[model samples]
Target: KTSLVVSYTTNGYPTEYIPTAFDNFSAVVSVDGKPVRLQLCDTAGQDEFDKLRPLCYTNTDIFLLCFSVVSPSSFQNVSEKWVPEIRCHCPKAPIILVGTQSDLREDVKVLIELDKCKEKPVSEEAAKLCAEEVKAASYIECSALTQKNLKEVFDAAIVAGIQYSDTQQQPKKSKSRTPDKMKNLSKSWWKKYCCFV
Candidate 1:
């Protein structure tokens, strides 16, 4: 089973602009199958995140904490608050940090500067540091608009989640599939032919 939780914040705060939205987070249970569960949570700030916690804890194999690369505040919120909150409940879950909206860096920079003047600066470097501190399995930049690195981000997250799961799984008994198995068979002409073959 696989699952995902995505959150976003738009506008800013106090003034209350429209909350940012998210594309569906999807997963395939098999190699050539449609996703069993593709959930989207389009909400603002901590409220949406709080609503997502239970779903994440219950269903998700990987938690992708995504923030707009353009919006420093979004990254800051994840690193400083959201990630910790999620960890408290799902500490073992693998986290994949996604820096979204990479295509809108210029516009985002302007917004960031404005926020900075208003004493609400967003720092990309700071966000990266925070991701490192929290031991993110991977960090990637993506753009939903252009679909840049979208697959890469999710693929990395899935890979990290699978690796983490494999590490946690109990070792199973080894199944013999070697010369020993062949030797255990009857030493008939057929067996010899099979062995040589």
Candidate 2:
């Protein structure tokens, strides 16, 4: 998860593994020719931070529920742990299931290590199936190291966030305003939309 966030924000992989409690990044991206500010929160998934993680989910518009494709245990944790926790806190937020580390899924060294433990990389089909089971908005596989499908993951997240925000605000719209006026999103949009992963 740290690798994904660091690579996306910095355009380079970290030299070493540094445990993070929680970190956030902001980026200005163009979606449909409009500037959108995205606040991405990289929350810790370790058991130690379990008590503190939910504090960040309160106002989240979308979630990127990520698991490593090369690690079966991490994939298991997606369903066994992360999804339930996110749902408990932000039931209405959209979730995009992400399979990270796609570049290492076929690495010889990693495969050998996994073979020793009688495990294999999580297949794309299984991840998609899990996404359906958990009612995720979408499923995407990406490699932070090689930067494959990295942009697509965030792009999908942005679209999902905007769509979810639209749904939440639909009921509050005045009858005088037509549906076409919805495109006039507030300039202070960053204050309302935050994505967690």
Model 1, residue 78: what's the lDDT?
A: 76
C-alpha lDDT score of every prediction, in listed order: 0.51, 0.85
Candidate that scores best on lDDT: 2
Per-residue alpha-carbon lDDT of model 2 for 44-80, expressed as tens digits?
Answer: 8789988998988976888999999998999898889
Off by over 4 Å in 2: 171-185, 190-194
**Model 1, position 111: C-alpha lDDT score:** 68
Give candidate 2's TM-score: 0.90
- Using all chains and alpha carbons, the TM-scores for the candidates as numbered come to 0.59, 0.90
Error of 2 at 7 (Å): 1.2
The stretch of ten residues in a row with the least summed lDDT in candidate 2 is: 185-194
